[model samples]
Target: MLIQPVADLLSRNADHYLIPADIVANVQTDNNLYHAFLVLTKIKYSKIPVLDHAGHFEGLISLPLITEQMLGFDQLNVEVLMEKRVSDVMETQVKTVPNVDDVESTLHLMIDNPFVPVVDNDGLFQGIVTRREYMKSFNFLTHEIGKQYDMIEKDFSTSEKSK
Candidate 1:
């Protein structure tokens, strides 16, 4: 695992879910639940990025936020009804693990966040690590180990049978 590439660890698993960096659905602070829902339905993610007038990460609009507001409103407007940007709702206090970290360390850090952003030494987002991915890799490793033991057992049994 020490010498293994992140790509190898990633490749052992078949499922890879990713969100595009730029295609985030967003709404102005003034938008309402109607607008939010419209955008959400179009985007692949329930978690939407919120941008300010200047086009920066302002907060995030989530299902919960829409639900909360829609519960009370018959009609909604963009300015009054729109939720904050992702910066507001996103886990701004991000916990990161280095790409070079061993699987064990990565597992430990993953205990908190389902997805941990992988970063290089310069702090650029290389990729993300998910508990599901780790579990898949672990499962593959265990399965391989089990197969080895089973082969050994079968070989011993064959030898004994001959004796």
Candidate 2:
């Protein structure tokens, strides 16, 4: 129940919650908007990471970003979808964290993102830490802390009665 111990608990164990890079769906920088859209649709994710040929993290692509570019005069422009690259419409200012970062940092980033992309020192895409996963872990920790606090209170009451 102590603030510092709880804070330390929250700061540890981010690595255990990661969804590894092999399972994360991503689009390449050179992929056309149409292809990126298809990937997002199939994955059912609003956004995903964009990687370069060498698998370095570049940016993030979302269905909305792709659709906005495809809209023209009240109709969808197929040409723009086919010709414009994902890089042209992707959000390059996305928040990213190194894999070594603690869950606290990851949690902070998740306030504005559904998932925080993890990268290596060289910016190679490592994986993602989703808000859903982090919240689940946090919920479990809260329950554990509550149980411990209850036991401590019981012990204190017994000692007081003995005194």
Candidate 3:
């Protein structure tokens, strides 16, 4: 049976883009150096995307990077630590999937990179899909398939009655 593509299951809701208001204030090039530490701390537990002023995709910052810096450095000052902008720290070369791609292709892409960014033809950030989200899509697909079968069966019965 044909299955809906992964793009169909992506959380198109705007809420997904809402970062935890309290977690880490969005980083700015002029923001404090220590802010990066806070942002890194937040990423330790969550996989969040970083964006630049132009709203272009930036590389993901994780807890490990933060921890490494903390360990290697003598002082944790913003200028010393936060010298890198999200643009500098982020993975400049990002792997993105098109909105129209099929679920199988999306899943494969996710497998290749657990944190895959979804982008439009113009490379605008649509949303991000983690491994967990991909699995959730699979489960959602299972239910949809069952629902389709029930509808088909109902239609078949109705046709028989009409005859």
Instruction: Give the whole-model CA lDDT for all candidates, comma-separated.
Output: 0.53, 0.83, 0.52
lDDT of 2 by residue, 1-163 (tens): 3366566555565567789988999999999998998999998999999999999999999988988887898787878889999989899998788873565677678888888999988999989988888787688777776764543544578788898
Question: Candidate 3, TM-score vs. the true structure?
Answer: 0.57
Better of 1 and 3 by lDDT: 1
Candidate 3 residue pairs that clash: 6-103, 33-78, 34-78, 59-90, 59-91
lDDT of 1 by residue, 1-163 (tens): 3434444554545344332334334665455556766787777556455545655443456666665544535754455345543333333445555553445566677786565555556544445556776777776666565553433434578788897
**Any runs in candidate 2 off by more than 4 Å, and if so which?**
11-13, 149-163
Lowest summed lDDT window (length 10), candidate 2: 146-155
Mind sharing the TM-score for model 1?
0.47
Query: Which of the predicted structures, 2 or 3, would earn the higher TM-score when compared with the native?
Result: 2
Residue-level lDDT for 20 in candidate 3: 30
Worst 10 residues of 3 by lDDT: 12-21
Query: By descending lDDT, how would the candidates be arranged?
Result: 2, 1, 3
On lDDT, the leading prediction is: 2
Better of 1 and 3 by TM-score: 3
Q: Can you write out model 3's per-residue Cα lDDT over 117-159, one digit (the tens) per residue?
A: 6666765566665666556656776567565444343458878
Models, CA RMSD each:
8.2, 5.8, 9.0
Winner on TM-score between 1 and 2 is: 2
Best by TM-score: 2
